[model samples]
Target: MGKYAQLVIGPAGCGKSTYCNHLYEHCQAIKRSVHVVNLDPAAEAFQYPVSLDIRDLVCLEDVMEELGLGPNGGLLYCMEYLEDNLHEWLGEELEGYGDEDYLVFDCPGQIELYNHLSVFRSFVDFLKNDGWSVCVVYCLDAHFVTDVAKFMAGALQALAAMVKLELPHVNILTKVDLMEDKNHLDEFLFPDPELLLHQLAASTGPRFRQLNRAMGGLLEEFSLVSFLPLDITDEDSIADILGQIDMAIQYGEDAEPRIRDELEDGGDDDDDDGGGDGGDDI
Candidate 1:
């Protein structure tokens, strides 16, 4: 009875929208009805059609102008405004799409939103309350980290998000195609803590050696967060990532078995009744 949704999230320039675009195209190619809800108030452009745009409810420019707030402040204001109107404006928009429709909510890239703030948690609660089985897709750029320290930092950032949101989460390493040596990314994907520790030991200060070991050990011990490589150029890669998400949220697992139309059954009965019309024979 509930609909499925993917809450696409990441830091800025991590290709959240691009990921959504690719996913939209994939669903369309396969004849799946997946709609997008743009939750980013400051979004400039979109590659896919939007089912419900938060900008229409509260634009960032409008908030900045009306309240004399900066861009970051304005964005926060817009999200709060959206939350206030979820029952009235946003609820109506969701109802228009109706139930059983898979929706992808392209969320804002601000790290604070997912980590420190409770706003997104409230948003997720709202979706769950409204009969939506929601999954969070956290994306990170594969090329963002050039060294072990950076990789560790990115991993911890993702870990923080996973802990904060507490949803059926999937971490994505986007733009793998942009990487020079894709093999360099293997350690992060499967997350070999020993390899990372060796690299970390080489880098960082002596005072932080214990710190690095502790952090690396914590990450390896939990093993909850792992990245899935996503190269939008490759169809198989996209499908593999999407398949993981679909299984996570149990997509299409609850659908009722389809039944034939009454007319179809009646037509079959008529065929058995008699082939020729009685009037024609007469």
Candidate 2:
């Protein structure tokens, strides 16, 4: 049996780690056992407790020292190495867990991993083959909501990942707490198709109008893109987000129902025949 897992993915500085940390706390409050696995070989520090760490297998500093590769190159190399040894590295890391365990993987922020590369897909397949039900959590920065063109671009990138992974997914807009003027957030939250197209065309340069139109049409046609706002500071928001993901993975549905076995209506297993009944016995 394999474990249940979620891959938290997004571009750099989009608060993937922050989201993971917040999720860790949220799970704790709800009394749900969740383990976080750090998959970024170059991660410097993290706020959450890591159950399984890839740095044990490959660290960027060690790769750079031995192979003289730069940071980006080293990261790619580390991922490639993991891919080459998926069964060995990831298998060993996941040794102790039963099939019912839940894990949240804090993946690297490199967009290329999900965009055109097969590393992430391969990893997902490995987990599935091992019997895990996996979900992809793709995050975008809510700060980009103010810019129509940028939002379109980010949405398309997320869409591309959704199509490529072809798994259960949840799109999140992170850092909502940082927004000063959240009134404008509603426009981006539930976007109007035609209005979004017009705004995209106006904000972008002339060169991008055609691309923007195509993207806008795709989003409107399939209704494939929507984001749940995530404010790391708000516990309620975190709980809501976690609840959505939990539903996606179908967690806790397989447990046996609790049954009441106690006798009712003042029934007793033992009655002493009216307090010993010595006269009747004689």
Candidate 3:
């Protein structure tokens, strides 16, 4: 059986950590074994227990201090450094987990990494070659649903990441519990191109009308992007999002048959033992 992993990624403050924390707790509640890996070198605190952290290999603050780079530049440098040492550090660490293990990688918020960089692409390729089913989970702030323009930008970002990675992708609207108007989410969740184009035209100048139409058409035509709303306070919401990801990666598909086989074998042994006891009684 192959292992499974989900790359939890989004912009900073999009609740990646919170999602990880809740996912970890939810998995535990359901008696599921899961491990979370923190791929963010700059992350100082976490709401969930991290099984593996990038800071142990390279620290962003130290890189910024020693190499004299800004936050974004430092994060990029840290990831690049990780890429260089994947076989030495990450590969060895992953060997500890079995084929049935499910890993959740909490990645940094740097959009550049997924947008135009080869770092995460290389990392994902490495995981695939090592016999793991990987899925990309992109999170957007739920508040973006309130504005058509903001939602479009977030959708485009998700689309870019999906195209670049070429993996089983899941998009999430995080922090739904914080939204003041839940009704605003329905339109964005099940988007209509014409409606969005009209909204965009009203929000922007006439000069950008054609561009908005084109963008809206792209979203509607491909039909590749949609978001699962995530409310950390709601267990059903979390379970629904997790269920979508599991289906994307086909997690536990192989185990079901194996479990059935084991049950059948045990039943056969029980029947044989019962026949022997009945013969002895006669």
What is the lDDT of every predicted structure here? 0.85, 0.85, 0.91
Would you estimate the TM-scores of all the predictions?
Answer: 0.88, 0.88, 0.93
> Across residues 76-138, which tens digit of lDDT does each residue of candidate 2 receive?
999999899899978887778876789999999888889888999899999988888888999
lDDT by residue (tens digit), candidate 1, 126-158: 888888888999999887657778788888888
- Candidate 2 lDDT score at position 207: 92
Clashes of each: 0, 0, 0
Across 151-224, the per-residue lDDT of candidate 3 in tens digits comes to 89999899999999999999999999998888667888767878888888889999998899889988888899
Pick out the ten consecutive residues of candidate 1 with the lowest summed lDDT. 255-264
- Give candidate 3 regions above 4 Å deviation: 266-282
Candidate 3 C-alpha error for residue 13, in Å? 1.0
Best by lDDT: 3
Candidate 3: residue 137 lDDT (0-100): 95
Q: What's the residue-level lDDT of 5 in candidate 1?
A: 92
Residue 113, model 1: lDDT of 88
* Clashes by residue pair, model 1: none
Candidate 3 clash pair list? none
**Predicted structure 1: lDDT:** 0.85
